[model samples]
Target: MSQDHSQDHSQDAGAALAEGRGRSAGARSSDQAPSLRPSLLDPLFAPARGLPGIGPKMAPMIERLLGTPERPARIIDLLFHLPQGGVARRLMGSISEAPPGEPVTVGVTVTGYRAPQAGPGKRPYRVLVEDPTGDITLVFFGMPAPRVEKMLPLGSHRYVTGRIDLWDGHRQMVHPSRIVDEAGFAALPAVEPVYGATEGLTSRAISKLAHAALDRLPVLPEWQDPAWLRQNGLPAFAEALRAEHKPDGPPPPVATDGTVPATPARRRLAYDELLASQLALALTRARSRRGPGRQNAGDGGLLGRIEAALPFALTGAQTRALGEIRADLGSDRRMLRLLQGDVGSGKTAVALLAMASAVEAGRQAALMAPTEILARQHHDRLTAMAGPLRLRLLTGRDRAAERRATLSDLAEGQVDIVVGTHALFQESVAFRDLGLAVVDEQHRFGVHQRLALGAKGQAVDILVMTATPIPRTLALTFFGDMDVSVLDEKPAGRRPIATRLVSTDRLDEVVAGLGRALQAGEQVYWICPLVAESEYVDLAAAEDRFADLQAEFGAVVGLIHGKMPGPEKDAAMERFAAGDTRILVATTVVEVGVDVAQATIMVIEHAERFGLAQLHQLRGRVGRGAKASTCLLLYRGPLGQVARARLEMMRETEDGFRIAEEDLRLRGEGEVLGTRQSGLAAFRLARLESDGDLLEVARDDARLVVERDPALRSERGRALRVLLYLFERDAAIRLLGAG
Candidate 1:
């Protein structure tokens, strides 16, 4: 989420712009009538033009860089856009003791100038200057000789700050970044904050905008619990913002770099943000609960039919999880729940049973998968388990007749269960009565997508399932609004996967072993990281390996990658499933939701390049069968510390939850599930790794605040509403509607 925060801020600006455009001034004022401080924060939320130093030309550029592509930039965007780092600008009188490669400010006299010769090649324009200690050259490229001479006339004094360089046994400064006279030097600070700026938007310009934003900050009330604040010694909201924007000196030596540190001031600001986020999720949950939902209870007839048909008995964890889902379905409130289970933990079985319950209630149920292949896989398995119940698969690949038939069945209440990809949410795929909507790979979809699915049927119960085991802290961060059910136990007779580490240097020996394994009538999965040859990345490709193995093993090898056509990929998988292809070479497309029961051996090439969670998932592929399975982690030599630790942990244990916690610690939250790709919330101020402790307190405080004043008309609630808007979570306020 840290990476998405910038994009989110931009979108927020765009939404604010659209909102401003649609409403008249009178309407805007009228909208603020619910609050006692009517439009008090409007000054802060106003457009960039409200800032003193920002002109019209710079406003669009600032908004382009600062705001999201959809909206205009505002004063609040500038406020949250904190500094990246600072440039220490200590004044120095001499340069003799100034070290090379370090920035130094020195005053010098303009002794002489050497202009580039007007010839075929463009040379540098050099200015010779001398200070009290020594003489140095200031080299400038692409500058006119007249301009150089005018700025540095003989005997004139100027101050400059730049990296001192020694080139060809001569002290030279290549294009000083900053140059000023005595009066300009006097105005410069000893340490200047550096900001993320575009070509037209400079750091100085952002700094000015930030200063203007700070000037307009309204004195905010303390929204935090007083005891918690006293215990933490946190500063007031306005005081924290001021201290962060205007540090007394250079920032302390902390990993915060140029961004706000976890100082009392910065932590206070972070708590405010966390509180706002939690409050928004809570409000959304509350608003959804306000809608009346139909109670679709089951008599256990359909569930018994499916479970009795199963060969193996249900695990205790599965029973508990099913009980939770059944309770949610029986209740009048809509079920917005998360079904979290690791790979091969029987999550699909539980989902099938839940859908069976929906069928027993005489309502249609739909299971949405992230991919076409996964949707088909779910359809195939559930169809087999469902016996007499009608199960249909819908995907984009369905031909006209097939698609028309499925749509007619769905809309006519003829289909009891339908499983498909995102096509389920399309406008044409109307259901007679969609009681339960089960979403697989929950993180892959966004919040609005869930809402859209819910809108298809009146108060549709949503049960999102995720194979990737998220840490407890991260689960709350991503799915705080929903009740969570964990399938901790694997099914009976499930064998523990024997994980082993091997180097790629022993390719011949490994091939010989694979030959033996194939001769023994066992299936093997050779996982590659890439599809085709990429010059930029030195990773093994599945196509090349498939070709290599085809020559050696002859038609026993099959390749499946993301670049392959949908039918080809499905064909390759089908051949592998039918034992026509004993060796399957694939990419990470096989990392999630792919279940191969006959597969007994797993080979992950360049395992060092994969994260801990992915390595765990890939390993889970082999242990599904009844036979004893082995996972060989093949890596090149010279593994990094993190990679070595990751592989070692995989070998040590197969606990998905533990691996997830370690993955969060090793890669941070951004790279684990991918902040942008998975739609994970990217926090701007608070870090999940270090700021996890604060999250619980923030959640509790937000709940208490909402509990006391659900309408948020109280004075403190008004201040908290401003906090929400500042964090781009004003949607929570709008959910309350005029109160």
Candidate 2:
């Protein structure tokens, strides 16, 4: 976890895992333009060891705190280190007027000194100081006698600054933060900036390093729109960085409750960061569409065949989503689209139809799932409904002979559609005319992995699908490059899940009710909060619950969790699917894409511990069947406002989109569970809740600039390119060159 000293800079200062790890700079783009590095920023990108005081011993310490494991701390990283807050140390006229415990500077005469004895047991060297209002003791834990005598001769006047305390029946100053002569007093800041510190690195030391960084600030062309900056009354980027580091007066006022305020200077810096991110995404989107796209238009022959084979009709939302994807596939520009829906919202059907279109165009399509179970699930479902379209399943679990045959068939273009996990991206899994690349549960795969898969086929149309409905802010940050189509409606006959919150103290009553439901021949799902008993967590474990349920239900209850072997988990799921077991107790391993039509009960243990969106997903498991489904959210008592709000929202509505929006507002975007792995740009200064208004402005600005100047050759564009490098979006610039 990152420690914030003055304010939360987790988004800004946090070293994000590199955008697409394992991607070589040469491999990403075949651009003709010069390298993304413009000669002007070389000094900033230089190694931290090049800094005057940063020797070998100190460099590693700084890197550990500020740099990523992949890259050492650079001078540029130090340049972006904004102060956390300000510390005020205004000079007080006399010790009598100085407020106790508050920092104050005082002028005093060194009246006398008490040196430690020649041989002693932990004695401090004390110096006596006096002024017109009062006298005070200066305490130093350790000081060489000769040096101390030379510095503070008896009766010599000196300036001391530190927090004063009433000690041992007299006033005293412990280890003065600053002691200066008359000339040095004139240069001391009335208020100083406070920064986060690491071991062996003092706040004062960090402040000195930051000042050194500011001294090297280069004069550059303006990047922001002149009108926006003028209207906002914001300073230039360089001026803003300087002003934030050194306030002219007392520090900006924090809220009475101690929350950090978004001062104008801070907001300006925030805008710069947000603007950089928005611009990079806009550029990437533009680059993806720069070249002529492969128009894999089909005659709908294969789609018609698959549709005829389906057991049920398509939902209106799914049909509309399919239309959008079809249009993208037909267009001259490559299709980079995102398909979002709630759990069990039929995303796979749309994906299968899209793949059929690719096959009709004489091109093979591949669907990559994040897990083997989900991949196999896709293969099974599609195999039954795909009609005559040739389909194959590829996974690590495949036998060597089977795998070799599948690979040969895929390379020879005999397989029309292939479904698999990350193994699909293996070097050996070659495609003869790969057209569409569909990624299921895209949040689990990083951006680089997606790119690697896309690189497998030139101008391959990319379609990413996510079952978790993401909020608008997150969508913009993570999938800004893709056109989005949402499956907002469930198919007809899918009943609204009846959700209820119950206290865990009433577990016995709930169990008795489950017994009755079992007697009525209705299937039940008992979801626990954890897989095993953890010393740190308080929630009930699935294994313990499965044992208890097995004891009571006599072999009718089934169990599965993430920790179990694949075959064992498959067996348990098969038992539940086949109705051999009526009650299945499990952990969240069944959170996504697990389908059991006969199951009608969802008992989520400690639901208050889950996010509102997660609770909604778990609840979605049961409503797939025709029978009425009840989602019993069993939670412990003494809930906080946020957790209570989450549970209340789940009880009130089944709309995943609405739940997602509420989740964003209730917990902010950081704790949404998937953003970290989604490779979304995490905002350092911009709060999505409060700074949402700026997103549109920044996005619009970025679009206009990229549309007018793709290569960043214009005066303003050059400066914007610098902004890109500063925020580590140089990858986007490389995309422009490749285009």
Candidate 3:
């Protein structure tokens, strides 16, 4: 669908003006007339000033609590802010009848008073209250005496509510939360809603502010299907919000009371977020599908040569993945597929086959890596694999004359397969007939960079490869715009890595074992925790370890870290690969793209500090060789419960897919995807850990919805537009231009 450029320009202008309104509060000229208007989301997203009781003082606190720098908080954020638990204020009539350590409300009479030591540094005030059955002391430390006297005077009847505690055999309330007179006490809620509070902000303040904000909530049209709502026993949007914001004592179940059960309100909000994400992904997919693309069905001659050159036969999973890629490239629609495999799972070979197919079709193909080292690695591997087929490498580190020669060859169709870093997208680089673009470690590249590579050719088919095994739900959320294929099995001759957990306290023992392994001519990787030693603290550094190991093992040991020059790192890697360096002490820089088939032993120092996924990736480094590899997880003693469980899980299985699921369970989706910038969705209410089941439902529902309303022009689609806007997914709606 082609967007109306003029309307988009107008909308952009309106959004700018609406944003400017926050800075230029004094500028008001009704006669000037508003040429363009902000959407409903504009007002809903306006600063806290737009909400009642959210004055300048409270807005900053709200921002801090929400962890956002955006001036105003969105209404959707408030709706999704579900309570963790609740406090009950149900009345028990008398202090004696109230359960100990439980919150209760009671009507009592002020029978006496005891003033504490007055003046500076004094406790100040205390009040004595009595019911027909019992008397409870109210202690107020550091409170003004006059205020306490005025509020709870002698013989005054009042209702008091708070936690009842026994102090030195005396029943006392540290602070009587409510000490209202007869008339004022009648107006107090029998059951009050408690909210999460920040410093200088009490629960009562939040409740008051939330109630005021709810009052200003505009009635929105139903965005969920009526039948679905009825089947799920969910209330309307406003009703659900109201129900969730108000709770009775003892907290309700997650279903009904809105505080505990899977309340309709929480489900509604979760579904809204899911729908917005799905809609955006679907729209992006649709736009890409509409773009012009070429069908490049390559001859199988070059692919045959590459297959013959392989040391071992391709696994069934690898073959299936290659077939999928070939089918996608052969189709008219541009391929945007994610090739996910575990470390050493043969993703590189699969990528090479796909590129060979493109080359055989008389079209150019480019493989882009995340870093210069990885790019150089890929270049070397591809050059060897496609040497008989004549592939070329172009990287940033290339000499000036060499780069010119490579670019000219690329422009003149002398290069069939080009491998490089992001430099592949530079203007000087041109493809003779670029058909496919393969990106390694897809998470490292942004959407714009990936699109730029695709833009280098007219409808270049995109194939992204990642060593990280993404959970199914996150795959749908993050890479929903693309098709996905998993390389589930290792190729023939691949060995399973034997993982072991060891205490770091036995450093001497580990070093002795490494010495024996090195004597046997077995390659070793002595991974260190830090790149360098600090003055304030001591930790093993890769360089320091390299020197120490060299003193014992002679020149057989080498060091590599991020601080080393690229050429130096590459040389170190080459020496290790060529069996010259028996021991390579390095940082986590070798975690991802570094591949050495002979390295059999892997040691990770301070393994407790690494996440499950990182641990899995690091373990993968040693298992590539035919000799049975062992991953020694050198953890510090006294491991925490979670860390112990993570290490045990790693030792239990070598399944990357299962490890990915456990990682998601232990470390949430946010951390599992690396940083927030990994393009993982930031959920407001739904949690991938607790809400894993909901993700499947949401994914299916989203796919079904898009299938029915591709353009999102139906009534349900219109309602979904409100959902998109509500979740601040208006960008997805704008893509459709449905309005």
Candidate 4:
């Protein structure tokens, strides 16, 4: 670690981290401004290797910590590396009371020196230093004896900082971290920002480099509202960075539960990043889906007939969602709406009704699923609820003649709706006048793919669905560009699932329970984490469990996994769905949109291995029908704190939204299943778990800014443009009157 000799110029170093932006300039710039890079930012973007103190040997190590192959470590990138926390340079009165493993600054008198052997192995040049309480040995390795003597002449006074070690039954400090006179000790920072240092490079070195980087920063225009800053008691961008890097006082306090208070500077920087992201999304939404939309609303003929034939009435949430969709469909602006519903919330029904409206408008609609089984399930479910609307199924595995027939019928407008996987995106698949496109589990597809599907027809409205219930903060963070419609309520009479957490020591008892469940004529879903047995992970496998269950229950058991052939997988699922097989042992391949209301029992092996959202989804497979269902979470014992918390949570509640929020609290955003893959901006400075409250303010500010200055010609509008480019949201700036 670099010894902290002084804290002269580190104000801007930590400030640079306020906007944790990406590396590299974009491939193109806006024509309206022509030159995207202002001359002020050029120095900040200079390579780290070119910095004052960084040399050839240490440059690669810095790059390894910060840079990727696409971009070398730059001065700005070093600033992005924020300190983890502060370490106080505690001063001690005497050696007797000094903690053995803690850093303490102490005054001592150098007494005498003992030299190593002439030509040697492992012997050090040991010097004796004495305080009033006692004397200690300070050993220096691989140093010239004459130099060591000259540095510390007989009876010289000095201040030493570093830990004291109990080496060979004596108090010795090997190479005291810093040995300086009274002046250097006085210059030391009270609290040092602790960087996450790697081998060779120290936090001290990083701090100095950040200080150097900050010197290049020019006074920039403020993009935030002055009133909001004062109300929140937050600092400006530069002031925040300075406060973070230049640590003079004791560190900020952390809560008892390990929550760090968002110090004004940290909050300021986080708000900066959030505002940039929100503004970019607002600009894109303004330029794209706000244009004149196709009028795809029908006369409500098909929807009325379908509702009349329905077994149960739609929930209020579903009704409200449908109203929103209808309003978007009827408006002159194209619809780009996100439908977030918990498991078994009747989103499928709402989507079908939306599609039916398009059919009534004499325009065709298409639904795309992430998997073929899900597509088939949709086709089956929609066919039952579609009433007079014509529908066709398309897949890559279809026979040549039948596939051609389906395509020809679709192009000739013979089909009202087509359900398919990615095959529907093929060049050969043509639609007569595709009006509305519905994408299920949009996390599996990128935003560009969703738009590409909409591009197949003129002004095609897009409605994306997700079975995973995302917390509101994540919904805004990921789907901020689209209008949101939430199906918050379940259909009436939806069965409540009884979730049971059982230990694996009760294997025989669980099997016995399974036998009882089977004798009751209820179907079961047994989920495993792996497809095959492996010597590495000792978790249960679908194939082994399938064989064991099949032997015990005869031909009533079916097996399926991701590795199975498409047709074989289909057959296995069909057998289980049709009740030909009472039990299906499969991997998480069945986690998505494979709906079977008849299956009322879910047995997940190694439940601790799965996340909260996955466990909730697997449980959802059972509680869809009227009969009270049960979800058995089979886990092995000796659980970690997180695992035990997960199990207790699974047993406590089945509310998917509550479970989703808790999941984020437990495993954070990255490990919370499919959330991070939603094709949104990956945040470097702001974490969704803590900074979520600021997101709404940023979003509102962005919307108002876009409303007032659509072309970004005003002074603050131009500054907002810089914010967009700094955060690598350049696409939004390009949409700003490029011609």
Candidate that would win on TM-score: 4
lDDT of 4 by residue, 599-653 (tens): 9989999999999999998888888777889999999989988898998999998
Candidate number achieving the greatest lDDT relative to the actual structure: 4
TM-score of 3: 0.81
Q: Candidate 1 versus the native: TM-score? A: 0.79
Model 2 segments beyond 4 Å from truth?
A: 1-39, 42-65, 72-209, 249-259, 677-681, 737-739
TM-score of 2: 0.78
> Lowest summed lDDT over 10 consecutive residues: which window, candidate 4?
6-15
- Model 4 bad stretches (over 4 Å): 1-39, 92-185, 256-258, 533-538, 547-555, 676-681, 737-739
lDDT of 2 by residue, 1-739 (tens): 2332111222321112244321321112334233456666766666555667777677776776666644556665665666666756567879899878766789899999987766747777888998999999988776777777666688899888787899878999987767878988887786787666676666676677777777777776789988988999988888888887776767765544333567777777878877877787788777767767787768987788789879989999999999999999998899989999987788999999999988888898999998777888889998988889899999888899999999999999889999999999988889999999999887777666777788788789999998999887767766767789999888778888888999999999999998999999899888888898899997799999999988988899999998998778878888998899999999888888888898999999999888877787788889888899999999898998788989999989988999998988777776664554343434655666556667778878888998899888899998898887666665676666666
Residue-pair clashes per prediction, in order, are 8, 2, 8, 2
- TM-score for each prediction? 0.79, 0.78, 0.81, 0.84
Q: Once superposed on the true structure, which residue ranges of model 1 sit more than 4 Å away at CA?
A: 1-5, 9-68, 72-74, 84-209, 218-228, 255-261, 500-513, 634-644, 678-681
TM-score ranking of the models: 4, 3, 1, 2
For model 4, what is the alpha-carbon lDDT of residue 372? 89
TM-score of 4: 0.84
